[model samples]
Target: MTTNILINRRSIQILRILVSGIFLVAGLNHLLNVEKTAQRIEQANFKGIAYFFGEPQWLIILSGIVMLSAGFLFLIGYKTKWAAIILMAVLIPITLTVQVGQITSLGPLFKNIAILGGLLFFILNDTEKKLI
Candidate 1:
């Protein structure tokens, strides 16, 4: 029984780390390409959301910072449950408002949906046990 519990704990830790790593890498990419990302945000044209963050360079920078911070927290498994939830909250708007009709490739569209599903899984599986 003790060995089984130990194995389960280790499995959960690994899963958490893997999930966090994905966000961390994606966040870093966003931070690295702020200008391009901002342009994408502008293209999104999400009414007030774009206007608020598009014109001001500082707001763009701030958004990158927030994404990086939240992603890092998630990757390190520090408040991972909340971090995943925050990520989902931040991503859903962009997905709906920006990528909804613009996706020209089926691969990318499926990828986006897969990412959302993964986020939902993380949110729903916020428990003491490992899924894998």
Candidate 2:
């Protein structure tokens, strides 16, 4: 029983770290591609959502802020369930708007789907535990 408990704790720790790391890396990418990301957002043709978000500069910064917050929450396991859900909410719209119909190759498409799947798993697990 003790051994099982230890393993479960380790597993949770690993999952927490992995999920947090992914968010951190994604946040960094947004920072790195600020201009390009902003451009993409502008091109999303959300019928004014982009304008409301305020040009590429402000929008990119906002995205970075959101990602960083979510990443930090995940890292510290603070409100992790809500953090995961928020991250998924943000990622899904971004993915659908930006990557939809542009997947000429299977690799990128599968990668995005896999990330979504992982986020869903996190959300479901968190929900089941009432962690949020």
Candidate 3:
């Protein structure tokens, strides 16, 4: 007997779109609501987090733009590895600086890290594997 449980290239492409679309939407949402973004960061309960980021509200909007743009690249299959790297670049620092102090209690931190992990898998694999 034989089994075929794996997906093919087109399926992978759609999956990639779906994955990257998540970041794109999130970033766009953040940008559209800078005040809410700033408030959430402020709610981090880490005063130094804002001070460390410098110009917190502005930085929030900037990063939102970054994530949106990077997601677009990844979605369109342009410079894919680089796009993943860019997303990670934005993700890791924000993860560490903004959430590290309260990581143990923050669900969002884990979700962000998991997304980063997915992006890493998307970048490092043999270009034909599927990751959850």
Candidate 4:
């Protein structure tokens, strides 16, 4: 006997919400803790990337804004592909600058990888009718 669980639209939307929630919360934290988060970025293995972008605090704030807005869009199933692309753009540098090359960050690194996989789902298969 084989059990095949059919995934439905509601299931996918729930997964989308679950995936976007992390980015939404993280974005809020970035904006709320700009100084502290910037300091952490300054101490990361690739602080130069942050500096190259601009002031670490400003970068944090900018990324926070992007993540928060795009994450909300992603959660609400509107322009999901674009939102996922935007999020993946923000996530890559963060994962590289903060999580990579750190022994203690393996768990978070893999978590981001999993999140990437989830976002990739939207980017690859989001075929809902567009509103704009």
The prediction achieving the highest lDDT against the true structure is: 4
Report lDDT (CA) for all predictions: 0.63, 0.68, 0.77, 0.88
lDDT of 4: 0.88
Estimated TM-score for each candidate: 0.67, 0.70, 0.75, 0.89
lDDT of 1 at 121: 60
Say what the RMSD of model 3 is.
Answer: 5.2
Candidate 1 lDDT tens digits, 1-132: 233323455665666666556566656766787677767766763535656445634544655566678778766767767877887776665565557666564565566577667667667665445534
Winner on lDDT (2 vs 4): 4
What is candidate 3's CA lDDT for residue 9?
76
Better of 1 and 3 by lDDT: 3
Q: Return the clash pairs for model 1, or none.
A: none
Candidate 2 global TM-score: 0.70
Candidate 3 regions with alpha-carbon error over 4 angstroms: 1-7, 97-106, 126-132
Candidate 2 structure quality by residue, lDDT tens digits, 1-132: 233112355566577778678668878878888877777766654525456545656656766778789978877778877888888776765666566655554565566688777667667664224221
Write out the backbone clash pairs for model 2. Answer: none
Which structure among the candidates has the greatest TM-score? 4
lDDT per residue, candidate 3, 1-132, as tens digits?
655455477866886687797779878987899888777677665646566768877787888898899999889877777888888887876777657778566887887887888788678754544433
Per-residue accuracy of model 4 over 4-71 as CA lDDT, tens digit each? 44557777888899999999999999999998998889788888777877888888999999999999
lDDT of 4 at 54: 86
Q: After superposition, how far is residue 78 of candidate 1 from its true place, in Å?
A: 2.0
